[model samples]
Target: MLISMTSEPELQNGVGVQDSFQRLWTPHRMAYIKGENKPSGPEPTDGCPFCAIPAMTDEDGLILRRAEHAYAVLNLYPYNGGHLMAVPYRHVADYTELTAAETLDVAALTKQAMVALRTASGAHGFNIGLNQGSVAGAGIAAHLHQHVVPRWGGDTNFMPVIGHTRVLPQLLADTRKMLADAWPVD
Candidate 1:
């Protein structure tokens, strides 16, 4: 949330005037968000990170069953230990672009992912959502995906309110391996 403090013209270089209370995201995130560190410019091409997950299993921390149209990937910065994202293969922006069958498939996979994560991580519940537009907090607006974040009792405390930090126990790769091992076969 930012307010225009002065009559000064908008900053053109995208180094937007920082708000007084804003804290920094990670350095790498800043570069990626600012388009300085990203491999592709503006649009996705041959080397999309999500697309590379299935083919290059050694990287990207993919953690779930791979279907014809969609796959689940471990969140690099997880809200919880087994927080995962179910994303469509094609880079469609929103729900309108997805067929009814595709939407159903995403839902089915999301349910399976929740079960797998719960079994592997001992998570009691989940918070599932999809931020369709940037206003809703979708980081990659070009590719629509739904997040399945695991939750447990006592997981929430005063950290977000006081420390301004999130504590995650397992690394992305470990979570991926655990969840992938628990994925349903057939």
Candidate 2:
């Protein structure tokens, strides 16, 4: 619900006063903020979404690509448009636990994700890496996943800064299709 202030009196009440600003209410974010789907334990069977995602169809999983050891999927709560994650199929908490093959596969998928984002949306730059653990900002600390966030000029502005919200122009399904089509053939 957007409250636009037409006059100065609206700011005084601080309630549902009409405001001039166009609000983009995102009630969905509450889940992520509240850690709704986070794993209950350190195992794949403990409700780990990353571990469970592979069993689902690509569309249902928002998966862009799949390799023997890892896969690329869209972030359920994206920091930017076309944001992706390269996740190892194994449920490992830290990057050090990944086998050589899993490490190589995740790195390859991460690179491919950047290429796909560039090809799909002309991404000017990217922010890629993984949080080592819960203390380091890993939302799903029970599993290892590397972030691949695409960036464009002026992509960051008052929306995320002042408003603390992001305006995504495309749906996740559509974005998934675009990235999947744009994925490099390996």
Candidate 3:
């Protein structure tokens, strides 16, 4: 939908100078850049999505699987396709605060996520961990969650490094279905 006014050396609308590079428009990322949906406070009632998602339906929440104390859900802003998180239902901010049952459930779900991603997408490796706090890069620091990011050989390319954009081949809905189908049924 972006029409280039490159016929002239410079754009009259103050757009930009004409360049030989092609454009890849990812307007959806603007919401993230603008900090949309970010929680205003540290409480679950303060619009924390991790606390809210468990109450929604699986498809609506992009949830892959649910355990007794935790659940596995797809990341809304994924670092890679099939990127997911295992979150404890309790609104605990720190990992050390997790109950024994919650800890076991979260670990189980994270393992299930890895299995599902590998089965569905043939992921070569994984990046799995928790961002302890906002300072440690937790977007939603009010809740505790463990990330499960699938990785493949040569998945990193110049696009993310130079353009600061990640190219995801499949829609989030499709990925959710695929991983859900591949989830280990207990």
Of candidate 1, the 10-residue stretch with the lowest lDDT total is: 1-10
Best by lDDT: 2
Worst 10 residues of 2 by lDDT: 1-10
Question: lDDT tens string, model 1, 1-186?
Answer: 122233343467865664554342333334444744223522567345655566766345454677778877877656677888888877687888998777877888898897787778788888999998778887666677899998888888875557454666555677777888887664
lDDT of 3 by residue, 1-186 (tens): 232322344445787777687667677888788888788999889998998898899999999898999999999999999999999999999999999999999999988887888889999999999999999999989999999999999999997999787888888999999999999887
Ranking by lDDT: 2, 3, 1
Tens-digit lDDT track of model 2 for 9-63: 3344475665577666677788888988899888888999998899999999999
Off by over 4 Å in 2: 1-15, 19-21
For candidate 3, the 10 contiguous residues with the lowest summed lDDT are 1-10
Which pairs clash in the backbone of model 3? none
lDDT of 3 at 70: 95
Ordered by TM-score, highest first, the candidates read 3, 2, 1
What would the TM-scores of all predictions be?
0.74, 0.90, 0.92
**RMSD (Å) of each candidate, 1 decimal:** 8.7, 3.4, 2.9
